[model samples]
Target: MTRNFNYWSQKGVKGPSPSPMFGNILSYFITPRPHLNMQWQKLYGKIYGVYNGNKPVLMVAEPELIKQICVKDFHIFSDRNTNRRIHPILSKHLVVETGDDWKRIRSIVTPTFSSSKMKKMYPMIRQCLDDFIVELDVYAKDKGDVNVKIMYGNYTMDVISRCAFATKTNSHKDPNDPFIINAQKVFAPKVSRALCFMLLPTFVLKAFNMRGIAEESANEFFFNITRHVMKTRSNSQKKYNDFIELLMNAQKSSTNNNTKDVNHYDENDSSEAHHVNEGEEEKQVENKILSSVDKYITEEEILAQSWVFFVAGYETTATTLTFASYELALNQDSQQRLYEEEEKQAENKILSSVDKYITEEEILAQSWVFFVAGYETTATTLTFASYELALNQDSQQRLYEEVMTAVDSKGEIDYDILARLPYLDAVISETLRLHSPAIILIRQASEDYKLGDTGITLKKGQQLEIPIYAVHHNEEFYEKPNDFIPNRFLPENRHNIKPYSYIPFGAGPRNCIGMRFALMEAKLALAQVIKRYRFFRSPNTDVPLLLNKSTILHSPKRINYPFGAGPRNCIGMRFGLMEAKLALAQVIRRYRFFQTPNTDVPLQLNVSLAIRTPKRVIIGIEKRL
Candidate 1:
């Protein structure tokens, strides 16, 4: 442990001195990671070291260095830092694979999220949003506190289930459904697997044959479910245009081609192969090459991919929605503008929408990775976007205007239209910048490499932490770094931003594979909700939104009960709560309220009635900015 502490110093690098055994864990535990990381960067400069229980991890935030590592020198940093003790089920996942394995699997899965494929899956997402809007309508009608996290979580889960497995689930209505319950457990495990992985030595964990990915039961549930779905789909005649079916088609195509090759021709007989189909064969070959990069993926890989989709798509996207709604609520003007954008678009056109591993333990690990990666990140993006929009109405209104203009004449948004909405895209980009789903990008050095002219040499096996949050907030990279400014992402201004500095989904070849899908999911939901209902601050709203990363569900917490207690509680409790909730939801969607010169700071009250009431009240209300 002492030797590990000296590891950085020996290489002439500067960092805070780590204490015995615990290293920087004490500080890490007490301080929030983003703040702590920013402090470290200030003190030790961009390139420094921090110890995670004597594991020397280099923190790199400098843009040029980051570009070199993530893009220019990607071959030397291809693999993510891992304990190499992955569960058997997850061992084969693309996220876990390195070098050739990663390349092969990535090629096979890349086409699954292509523009054409996203177009095919858009209707499924649209259907899910229709249900989502219904649920939101209930909230709007009842005027109750909204738990956007849980609401968006269910929506993303519905999307993943439908798109990944061709299975429709009522997650929006039945949050306790088995699919969600199991997926949630995988993400927020009952046990602190992350703590264990960070604190326990590999040898100690291996001695007990422990798997860190998920509870064995959850793994089994997904494994069995994925296999069953694949089996049932294979035997069925229905041509479902979902993710699993796509993989199955790839597998089937590969099998048929292999059989044909064995029976008819050798690899060298290109002429003979062409003769079989004539003119159309050339077009087919080109299409196949473009669409299906490789059809040689195995059943295990396909199953792993399915599991990953569930894990990855679930929470992240939901979190984004949660924050986006919260922001819209706080910034009523922005919410109104967004609503206008959607409404105007409605006047114009229609709305449309919208990974894997290997090993028994390895396969489970892949599923675990997918669920964790996809689920919360996108949701969190929407959540933060809402929160920021609520605070910054101008940005939201700009986004709305952009959305309105981008919609087709039918009032529908298709894949191409969604892609083209610059202002809408800017809002999401700025949202991602402010509340980046990923705090850091981890990479392990494959060989000894020199970092710039800083005289720092990264040894083989060194772990690199690209502090994304820090870089994003650095004033050098962004003006008024902390402020939410979606305009910065507009095409004309985007060129001014540094490359590798605004990486919410990372950069280079190994960046998040599900980025396109996540963006589409978030953009569609934002457009739909903003058009129909406006979000505004309520008494239950949390200002500045204290983020508890460990907690996935956001429920309103009320401290003061103005109506009194127990049997003496106000008779209008239910009616008041409903009236308040509904009024805020409906009114805020259309207008903005604030204090005026005529409004008294402390309104005169009449105590004659059973309940003290304001004698007279005055305030200003206006149409959305």
Candidate 2:
């Protein structure tokens, strides 16, 4: 029996009948959930709408619309629509906060990550990298096929913990550090994804939070570390230029200058005036003057921000580094070329004699490569680049030649020399274009806003997401968009690319702050690996890359190479990349990598927060003269 329904309204407004409940459920379970919105975009037009239960959601794919939400209308969409039930740990932190509170916190914390401060912290970063290299040497000497992914995570965790928190987390040495372990448990996608706290019903899931890793333990671990750092800084007579010092000073100044207490102020005000009869009174007042005009950050705020920094800085960098090694294993030619470049740079007579033997400057420069490229797109690029190289050896060899030539001219791998390697840069750019790390950048509307020519009004509290994976894969923007072709990033073709079409790190004020760092790290790592070793198709590797649907970052389902990309991206990207480069260089300089009979191609992938091989990435390693 057909029931007649009026489908069209007065102004050509068309509405389809409600979809069957079963169909919706089936769609949720079977389809790649991440791509579901993108699929809808194709069917319902760019600004299509959907309902997660009764909640209305609008998915925007048009670059301009995305830009407006993230940048132009940033005030309207500054909060991240974080699921409190699923991500209770991050609920009170800066990443999920909104409105004036976010602004104030960001203002106070921004100075901690300024370029000048980061430069000062480079020495500490180098120390972490040195430890990583020693660890790698131990692994290599054992002649055991190490899971590069796990090792990479350990390296980044150690670096970020020490550099950002000014604490000796020592995750590399103590793999079971409660903070590191609990932090990983917190982001486990399977558990977090199922808890979908963004929907209004998020409160219902809070009951289940008791079952997983105890939230208190994680919270305590983070807070204790922060409190220790804070107490040490506050009591110390000496001053240091670390992030902790900045926060401590800011907190003290804010607290002292606070005039909110009426009674206390009245008493202090009278005492000050009474003592101002002599010149000595003015001097005394001047000496007692506070640094700030207002009170803002509380102990809780400091602890919360510090916790966010650790969580944000560590896991992301670790994941990227893990993926980077996977890519190096697959792309031998690219790896060899990079290594040759490093060799050339090291041999350059222009550099100080001390630099040839790993001077602090050399370590700093090399370490930056690791930290910047360790995670985000660099690691993912390495993975995808290797996947393509393994599939298309011709392109891999061509890129190798370009890197080799570029490095040879300088006789060493200098920043300026590396920059001139167009083809190498192209290879890196192409990898980022295809396999961006974070597929979606989500923000919540803080106030009412309009988007695009449609003039659609987004109400306050609405969730905004920029589907980066969809944008990168859009056929209109890229020809044979699915195919891996490094040449697309070449100078001749790069100009043809449209603005905003490529946003691996996003764009504008909110774009990734760590982009330069990530890129440099990836280049150096890739350069070093390519110079020393060669890669071939491993039978153990999955032929077509399978993505781990659970992660925010587009992690692979199997062991893959390279790191991921973005700004507000990974802070340890430079450190991770350098580790990969150095490890690959040392190993490749001594041995060659080859596919073994035991190696599997078209291998199955285990999808999770980070990509992992179902089994070992079994390959034969042979010593080379």
Give TM-scores for every candidate, taking all chains together and pairing residue i with residue i. 0.78, 0.70
Residues 195-273, candidate 2: write the lDDT tens digits: 3432325446666564222355655565566666666666688865654565665565543553332111111111111
Best by lDDT: 1
Candidate 1 stretches with Cα past 4 Å from truth are 142-144, 256-295, 330-369, 406-411, 549-625
Best by TM-score: 1
lDDT of each: 0.53, 0.44
> Candidate 1's residue-wise lDDT over 125-166, tens digit each?
777777876776766553444545555556777777776656
Displacement of residue 71 (Cα, Å) in model 2 is: 2.5
Give the local distance difference test score of model 2. 0.44
Worst 10 residues of 1 by lDDT: 559-568
- In model 2, state the lDDT of residue 586: 31
